[model samples]
Target: MFNKWINEPKYFNKEKETIIIESDAKTDFFVAPASDYLAHNAPIYAFDVQGDFTLECKVRPDFKAYYDAGAMMFYVDEKAWIKFAFESTDIGHPAVVSVVTDGASDDANGEKVDSPSIWMKLSKKDKVIGLYFSHDALEWRMVRLFQFDVKNLDKASVGLEAQSPAGLGCKVAFSDIKYTDKAVEDMRKGI
Candidate 1:
């Protein structure tokens, strides 16, 4: 049900039950407001889903360079999208980072995680979307909650994304992927 969008990855394999994507060198999806530079070359394996839903996955990135991330993406178009990522931050650690892109992207870094992997959840209820991350996939902490106002926000593609913005490349493994055609009742608790 998933297909590649934009740039093709160096390696993509889904036969092992765990999805693995090796992002190519300098692959990313960002529109910087400071320099007004747009980069939308990252590979995304996504499928269109209608109505409100919850998408969850465990992302483990081979964090080799700064800004390298394995993300759960909510995509609308090149100019509008959300990247809820497990990223190797510039602060010398892996952290939860969310980027809400509407023409220009706004980046926010959340909780710092010491683990090799983390579980990410993206829930959509009408025009509002919530992002959450968990250490053990049971207790989740909110990363972002905002309205993604667009023409067809309810009918968008949700998927897995990998980017290596600064390094040559990195492999990202996505496992325990789950999807439900319902919204989370509580946005604050993310359960």
Candidate 2:
């Protein structure tokens, strides 16, 4: 089961066959060493994650502004965490982005896709974590493969997130949710 959101969203449910998240305002989670603005205010729909497990969801954002995104997040603390987002890029395209923060957030962007909707997945095997995105749920493309070192990492928060960092807000719908107590065998394999 998941805990209540960090900053509760407009709507949330853990018992549904499918899940949905609708968020408002400029909510985001980031530790920006450059600006001295550690913005960890995004509405996080999270749960305890232990050992080897995979967390995934499908997100469809009414992306109307640059930098707006819906993400799959893993939080160890404000200073150390990760977020994989399906965001509206500055070039006016939807792209996949991965942000890993040890001290300051290292933001990386993947290819710009042609859809407003995408599926994001996170696999945790020990300290290694893989992030992937898919146009459809059947085939997945790797975004980033990395590792993190966190003390008492087990049961650390992992879940769905949404942000409107450069706009008023956006409606992000997340569905087809699954939290499995197993590793995604091949991180590069299709779902």
- TM-scores of all predicted structures: 0.96, 0.91
* Predicted candidate 1 versus true structure: per-residue lDDT over 101-176, tens digit per residue: 9989998989999999999999998888999999899999999899989766756798898999899988999999
**In model 2, which range of ten residues has the least summed lDDT?**
11-20
User: Model 2: which residue pairs collide?
Assistant: none
Off by over 4 Å in 2: 11-16
User: For candidate 2, lDDT tens digit of each residue in 103-154?
Assistant: 8987777898897688888998889898888878788888887778876687
Off by over 4 Å in 1: none
The most accurate candidate by lDDT is 1
lDDT of 2: 0.80
In TM-score terms, which candidate is top? 1
- How far off is residue 137 in model 1, in Å? 0.8
Model 1 accuracy (lDDT, Cα):
0.90
Q: What is the C-alpha RMSD of each candidate to the true structure, in Å?
A: 1.2, 2.0
